[model samples]
Target: IMVLLVLIFHLLFSCSHSLQYFYTAVTRGINFPELTAVGMIDGEKFLYYDGNTRQAIPKVDWIKNNVKPDYWTSQTQIIRGSEDRYKASLVTAMQRFNQSGGYYHPFQWMYGCELDGETGATDGYSQFGYDGADFLYLELRSTSYVAPVQQALITKQEWDVAEAERRKHYLTKECIYWLKKYVYYGKSILDRKVPPQVSLLQRDPSSPVVCHATGFYPDNVKISWQKDGQELHEDVDVGETLPNHDGTFQKRAELKVTPDVWKKNQFTCVVEHKSGDPIHMILTEEKIRTNSAGIIVGLVVAALVLIAVVVGVVMVVKR
Candidate 1:
């Protein structure tokens, strides 16, 4: 499930510029707030609102510094209205599915627009999910809604073409307008480049060597393994780029090889980022801290501490 989510994130933010909004609502059985909404620009969260808080909060420094308080106030009111409507819709969905009491159900609504930096092209999408499955989505070309599940068919039938047109207009025109405005407001942070710190790590001698890179800005990064200066596609697992606590990005690629193979040939992990030139790290036994070595070092430190404690006791008795 986490891998799938990471793949989805990569696909959605592959473009240079994008603006997305996500809303989630859950039924009463869950121990969560009734509704939550998030706004992201270029895969970075900038705005957040939840039923518990009932206030729209800025997630980034640029948003808090550049955007006015009035904007948050208006957004709070609009989201509060949305929360009410989504709560009623959840109840209606329960009836539509013929679900009774004590069952947890979740609903999600997502809409976004993407802009190509080089070609000036744009794309938009609006979709909904129910219970972790696709329920309905908008078809912009036909200006109609598509129901992916039987339970959503009734809702799709009730939605008219005019509503679809309105959604389309908002996704294409208004969303892009706001996206541009936010981009200009956050140009300093968004445009800046930061390189990653790369390392090769292994849990034990038998485990795969993982090339880990962290603290990089702009999540787009390429990590690959090379054997004897040539790229090796097989016996390699490339993980997704994940966000760090400080808003930087992290990624890893693992290379599976025996000790003999790596000892004979030069194994290198290469990382490419927009910040600067590509980074190359040659894998070596000394560079990786294995579990066995760590255990031995831990025991040595423990022995030293025990000796110090014994010496302290003897000195106190002598005093």
Candidate 2:
């Protein structure tokens, strides 16, 4: 029965899904974020702290529901700790890692840790990233790390022991049972569909034209720029599709061109996603706005002009 359930969960939850950072913060004595992945299972991440999403800020609901009961309350000795402190440390670590004083960490994007302290370990698998119409483009795990260093430091015997411990502590627990159940609950959320918004951007007349696509789902997307019906590869800079806080993704394709070429040629930004047909964008003055204010101002000015024309026509008729 247990075997069947595990297989069922593994099948369902393993797909185009959410970007979850499952973490176990131990704030008792040790203040460092744990880098334990039990042999680095599905784990990778790049977080933006100061950005619009404020992803650095941990979800209190997740902390309270999952981290609190599973890890904190499961201790045999009941050594109480502070989840609040742990949450703060998590946010702080995200900030420090993202925006350090002087040092730069080339790698350290996606991050999640299983708290093995007082709480019983995060049971089962977690579905993050795509919530409702969100596309977590990449797996929310760190793909590149100190692999050579880990190989040098961790011996075979040490590895065998750690694996044994992980299996014993993680696989055979009641948490595992609950985890599969939770995955079942989150299956629909993970599979939710979201469409992308395509737009063209350019700073003044001399700058390169940028094509942006934001808020898409299922993560399987491709965006590229084309001119004269031929895809241009030279001057184009296609960015990696990245996750948004709402679970959607954002990608930008840019190209540098002469002012004459920019004004004359009708360049296209084409996006293909799982939900539907390709979304196409062509750069034009009427279609492009730098920000929401530009849109509002344009609307307001147009409205005032319309009002003036209506009043003038009415006065002429009266006269």
Candidate 3:
């Protein structure tokens, strides 16, 4: 009787496993694609892709299947958008790598959160380029979990590990391409519209010709002030941004240059990243006229000096 009972239990377990497999195959609902399938990494829900629908979606665990024997985990988060959508979208991601033999194993990862909404305008349908109504194009990559192993030398079972590394490289390139597209269109959008972060309502000349920037992958940013295309080395102040709490960082940098530079030269705030092209802000004189009275007074004084010089020269000639 005991033998019969054990056989029954074993049969039930087998049946259950088979049923689960069958159910997954039959149900379309269970086949939802992870965000990674669409090229996003795992993280908390920052901005909703379908704001009215679901707030967040789990990232695909492709890296898990492709795990290396030497390394523990791999992860990434990515985004592409114009200043408005990027800042407003607020998408966030998280990743971790659990290493062996080390007391403190550091995971390497990065996040990009910004909007590129130019395509929406030009084609009269915002979904053409990168910004779709519910879906945006993005890619995430990480080389932080690098192991000492090589793919060519690995066995078939270890091929997944090599694939993970390969995927990282592929995603990195994909991310760069998307970022460039966003930036290209983002610049065009910026030329037409002022960013919300830039306070157009309040004019403060004393604000150091301030240029503020917020970025995902905060550690990779190298921000500087430039005068007529030359980099400025003085009075740069970088501010701490609130973390996304997903093991990723968001940050802002403030660079201070002379008011004259902001006025006479094309004072620009340039932001450079490790994997992508640079982002820049060209200062407009009108944007910096916080001291309207001072500018007016300076103009008046110059005009009066010119008039006086002309009158004195005329008097000397007449005499």
Whole-model Cα lDDT of every candidate shown, in order: 0.77, 0.44, 0.32
lDDT of 2 at 162: 45
**Per-residue alpha-carbon lDDT of model 2 for 1-319, expressed as tens digits?**
9999777755665542222233233222333332111111111122212211222422223333434344433431121233344345444543533443333111111222232223334422321111111111111132111212222223223434444445345434544454444444444544565788887776566767677777776566788878878888988888655445455566777777765886698777788886788887876777765554344334335534432221111111100
TM-score of each: 0.79, 0.48, 0.27
| Higher-ranked by lDDT: 1 or 3 | 1
- Candidate 1 lDDT over 15-88, as tens digits, reads 47888887877777567677888887876888888788899999999999987899999999999977888888
Query: How high is the lDDT of residue 182 in model 2?
Result: 42
Provide the lDDT at 114 for model 3: 31
Runs of candidate 3 with Cα error greater than 4 angstroms are 1-203, 240-248, 285-319
Best by lDDT: 1
For candidate 3, what is the lDDT? Answer: 0.32
- Estimate the overall C-alpha local distance difference test score of candidate 2: 0.44
Model 2, C-alpha of 26: deviation from truth (Å): 14
